[model samples]
Target: MNSNFDDFVKQNVELLDQHIDELFDSDSTLNTDLKMMMKYSIDAGGKRVRPLVLLAILKAFGKTPNYDILTVAAALEAVHTYSLIHDDLPAMDNDDLRRGRPTSHKKFGEAEAILAGDALLTVAFQWISSTNLKDRIKSELVLSLASDAGASGMIAGQLLDIQGNQRHYSLAELKHLHHLKTGKMLLFPAEAALIMKPSKLQVAELVKDFMANFGLAFQIHDDIIDVTESTAILGKTAGKDVDLNKNTYVNLLGLSGAKEELNQVLQKCEQDLTSLGELQPEMDLMILEGFLTYLK
Candidate 1:
């Protein structure tokens, strides 16, 4: 990754950490154990990809990062963290580690981890609504987040993923599954940023197209990493996908094929970004481009 992205990521992550930490402090009604588990997972290391992507998209459109942006970013991260906590449960992917630490369930007991996930998911909306942004903007963000993280989105993807163990899915079917499971959250950043800047609504579809390809490329990269990286490097159990018999790009397409597909998807991302640049010359796409390059 480029130095610019590295610096942006470091700065934003610290800011987000502060914002998320403050959320619990202001709430007098949070249970101690529940708060501990939530903080455990939230403070547990993650790349904060969703928040970074959302902030990056807003930056591309000339919106400076501020407390309000941090609030929205924190909300996005909350939902993502909740998903990770739940996804690692015994009933789900049954992971034992995440981001190089004991999985939430492993560290906090199954019931506590479950409640922690529940708390994070529910409070994410509260964070959004509590933001100082206009009500319309806040509502739009909440709606986008809900639809993306809800039953028809990531949940559907998870359901399909579990069921995929029973049968081989066509490539198209796999894409559809991931488009919900992974793509929608990635897509939400772009959509949310566009919502914030109605002036750039004309390129909404173009931006969504870019994020769609980016999201798939991300998942493909993850599949490749699962096979190539070690448990230590991945910060999670390596080859778990294979152990779980989950459907993945690497399984459906050979390693070389998956790499080839990743390249193709990234190339599409570049094309989409270029089209956006053509429409809005002032938009800084270097950070966005760096994201694609980093995935490669």
Candidate 2:
């Protein structure tokens, strides 16, 4: 990644931290345990990629940053955090660590962890609905998010994951599951940002294609990490997929093949970005590439 991207990432991350702190800091007065649990879940320090990507998309269109933008982006992060909380449950992946800290269930117990996820999910919609953005813009984003997070999207992907454990899926099947699970969330930000700047509609098609490829590439990189990195490096239970005998890019395509596939996706995303032909093309590419710095 370039220094420019590093700076961009730093500024956005700092702003995102403030937004999160202010938003959740108010909830601390509600119920001490639930508030602390909320803080624990959000404050555990993940990448904050979902919100960052939303802002990046908006910046690419030269849209001025606003509190409303941050508010909506925070909504997406809440949904993502909720997903992680539930994913670590005993009934799910049963993970014990996340971002190098104890998983929510381990730290807060299953009942509280479950409520925390519910709270986070509801908070996401509340943020969006209460935002002062135009009603049409707000509704579009909420509807897009609903499809991505609900039964037809990530939830369905989770169902496939649980059922496919210890089972092999063809390449096509794997991509289908991932498109639902990870790809839709990535696309949601792009779609929502375009609504804020309808003039970018001409470029929206290319952005969609870029996000789809990038999302799959991101997951493949994750699979590679599980196989190659340590638990300490991953900040989560590494190689758990192998221990669980789960299907993954590495299992289906050898390590070398997975890397090759990742390269293809990156190349495709680059092509889509270049086709955008706008002032922010370089920034757009940098934003995408910076996320994959682990590959370097």
Best by TM-score: 1
For each candidate in turn, give its C-alpha RMSD to the true structure in angstroms.
1.2, 1.9
What TM-score would candidate 1 get against the native? 0.97
Q: Which stretches of candidate 2 lie over 4 Å from their true place?
A: 27-29, 278-285, 292-296
- The weakest ten consecutive residues by lDDT in model 1 span 195-204
Best by lDDT: 1
lDDT of 1 by residue, 1-76 (tens): 4899888888988988988898877788888878888988998888888889888998988898888888888888
TM-scores for every predicted model: 0.97, 0.94
> What lDDT does the true structure give each of the candidates?
0.89, 0.83
- Would you list the clashing residue pairs of candidate 1? none
